[model samples]
Target: MDHFLGIFVVANCYRNGIGVVRSLQNANYWYQKERDKQLVATRELPYNVDNGLKNMLLENKYRLSWIPYNEFKNIEKIGEGGFATVYYAVWDNKYLDADIPAALKIIHRSKKYSEKDYSEQFIKELKAYCDIGYDNPSFLECYGVTMDDVSKEYIIVMRHALEGCLRKNLSSVAMMGWQNKLTLLLCIISDLKTIHSKKYYSSRFT
Candidate 1:
């Protein structure tokens, strides 16, 4: 019954067809799976991303939304990357003013990065929203964290950028008048200033 750019929840994702939800809930799951304990033969790996996020939330390091798994429906896989897969979903949660469309960055568990690395990277990106200072108009609003019970992976629920990222809109941007281009430049510059003001710098390409 959700409506987002004409995208409706035809059916709930992570439901029966997904098989992930039920599989995760098997009793004594963690206790039985000392399989993971064996992975940490030497150093203690960072506890799962779920715990890391919860601890950060408690410390008030960054304000993040914690959306329950049940709140999401009609999850549609939209894209994939080396680290995570992106999804479009309808989020209906009590904390939200209203149900809204959201983009879910579901971090993959086993890939190029180990569980610890993925957890760190996941938290890092989410914290960037706060580091850039959410008060600034240019920062993408990070709604909060959602967990995929089946895979035990963390999903970042963020405000969906409908036109895709700025780079994707460049062709149309080129057609705009000088005034519009100038405005866009100012927004980007202003954001950079905000980051620099916080004494943060990045050499990341993007």
Candidate 2:
């Protein structure tokens, strides 16, 4: 009787083991299905605000005026220069198929200039940029140009640079070893050579 009871107990343990194995298999299958569903949902979702802005500009053929500046809502002032102040802006890009990320350099109107002078200078600057062409990526990319009807001020739309400027980088180089400084100087000279070549070509032909 003891031998028979021991055999029955072993059989019961084996059945329980089989039940646990089946339960584990079902759980793994459901987990995999849920993971796949999540991935598909993520792909279908709208792009983030920054990407949307970029897509909108690209899809609109880099036309700055078409972009609603108010919608972008300035994040911060990036830089200020002699002629204008640049602000970092973020916006939605629902118009674009790919929904690319974007940034805008908001150019503020010069306070020093009269309305007439502002108009003239704005046109002159626009012409200079247009004539120079966008061949060099180092050169700021101008996307759009517009003048405010009320302020009679010019705004140039440009691609935003998160890494800041060459001037700031140069300051960092000043603290570096002499070898690095020399290398940087050589690079600067190379850039100057390219600029000079472009100027020569422009003068010679057009």
Per-residue lDDT of model 2, residues 86-112, tens digit only:
566554433332221234433345568
For residues 29-144, write the lDDT of model 1, one tens digit per residue. 33122212211111222345457766766565445656677778888987777677889887875532356777999877766677678778878877776666444423444666
Task: State, as a TM-score between 0 and 1, how close model 1 is to the true structure.
Answer: 0.62
The alpha-carbon deviation from the true structure for residue 6 of candidate 2, after best TM-score superposition, in angstroms, is 69
How high is the CA lDDT of each candidate model? 0.58, 0.42
Q: What local lDDT score does residue 183 receive in model 1, on the 0 to 100 scale?
A: 56
Error of 2 at 38 (Å): 30
TM-scores, all candidates, are 0.62, 0.45
Top candidate, metric lDDT: 1
Model 2 lDDT, residue 114, Cα: 61
